[model samples]
Target: MRSTGMRARSVPHDSRPVHARPRETEYRPRHPLDLARVVLPQRHGAGDPTMAAANGVIWRASRTPDGPATLALRAGAGGHVRAAAWGPGAEWALDQLPALCGADDDPTGFDAGAHPLVAEAHRRHPDLRIGRTDLVFDALVSAIIEQKVTGMQAFGAWRRIVAWYGERAPGPTPKPMFAPPTIEGWRRVPSWAWHRAGLEPPQSRTIVEAARRGDAIVRAAASAPDADGRERIFTSLRGVGVWTSAETRIRAFGDPDAVSVGDYHLAHHVGFVLTGSRVDDDGMLELLAPWAGQRQRVIRLLYASGIQEPRRGPRMHPEDHRDR
Candidate 1:
């Protein structure tokens, strides 16, 4: 049943927050690009409260190192992306715009030559590039929430937690949205709140523990020499593992080689797409070994190919323990 309550007054698109004028930038990509494909992957789920897409504009709310910031991005002619940001961290977010839109992804050695599907997919979408948010703790927290759970369960928990604990975003967002809580805020999420959000005890504990040393973790990951260093940093946490590390890498650093080794469907998807049969994580690794540096890119290309392994059984219905 729809509510008959009065709706809040509408806000104009990207209207300046009362605090200050939006900091703006226009990015020109050297290669072909598709804004949605590059940016929307940053979203945890279709209903992610931190992000929204409407009228060809993508709006995002995030907690930057400086503070919470709202970013609005839209694609324009000639592979140009116009961005506007608001809040104290607006300048920081604007400075990160290029990397956020896949500027840091180097596809130089990715050989799509091995497989026809890979070749065709690469040819079809030359603009395909991995995007990164550069927010390590936030990405780690989201990845931890997703640990060992179905997408339905993880996304639902993420939505609830962020909407409840996060700060309301600045700027004229099309819909109400909020930024993820600060590092200290994550440490402060009560156990009752985690229970209400449908996050398991293990995941919540991991987030809190990680938050205790959040700055050190972020600094270590950022200063690490490569993906291996990041893996060490992430997996050192009691609750984090390879899957969570890979996911965090993909989101925060855009490590092209990072693969979620233990993902429920990833191995199957990769094997099915490349070998016409499902494979285990070991098999998937072997299959992807030929393109070690760009394995994740290959996986993304396979995804862009829109080919899926046919289902052999009924869908797994996730259990919701949340009280109504």
Candidate 2:
């Protein structure tokens, strides 16, 4: 049977001084860090059960290699990120905090001078970095949920699924959050549950199939030598395509070159920003060819430049599959 919502009560806070010592840590990155940019983009919706950001702090929940964990990150003085964790996977989450906050990202060799617009954007937000999450499965599942659907529909479905199946995050976060389901948990979700969440057969089936081989997928991504190699592993999965693979790599691996070539609005956005006219995917690629290894960075700069293509036609309507 499909669960309508989670019934679990919030875990009580521990009072023991030493054993219940707050599981907290901190990291100071060499590069300037923007807490909101690194974490907020990963949120699927305003009500995303896996994440919450408020009062300059970001809280996240995940099923890590060790177990379920909840993490809170706040920006502190002198480019430092203060973090706290709870649950069995607390240590693992803390250990991975540097990468999650983009400590490993190197913007060297990226010449913002290649384009006037890009240069202006880089001048405005030089601290921009592509953050990475070591949890590839989480990114993959979220990307799959957004496939060929309006943002409203996709976010609604994602929130429903997580609220129904995900476990409550530990610690006293401002808002209640849930850890995303583990791979085995995703495999166990029935078709009826997916339907209730407004997910169609194609996306739900793809997520289940991907979960079945989740371990192998994670290993392949970890072992791959380069962005291209990692992307190949992701695209090999059934129903996974170039756009989905790029989206996953951007979040999971932080591949700066991974452009969403097939995205409906990206090409137009790129074209309008660079050439003052709209272009198709092919044209966008041609214009961006000079920056072969940093295409995604270029797109990011274009977005930061505050240039947008004029809206035309009606917005895509959210589709509800439960009534069908």
- Highest TM-score, which number? 1
Candidates' lDDT values, in order? 0.87, 0.82
lDDT of 1 by residue, 266-301 (tens): 888999999999998899999999898999899999
Residue pairs that clash (backbone atoms under 3 angstroms), model 2 = none
- Taking all chains together, each candidate's TM-score versus the true structure is 0.92, 0.90
List where candidate 2 sits over 4 angstroms from the true fold: 1-21, 318-324
Error of 2 at 74 (Å): 1.2
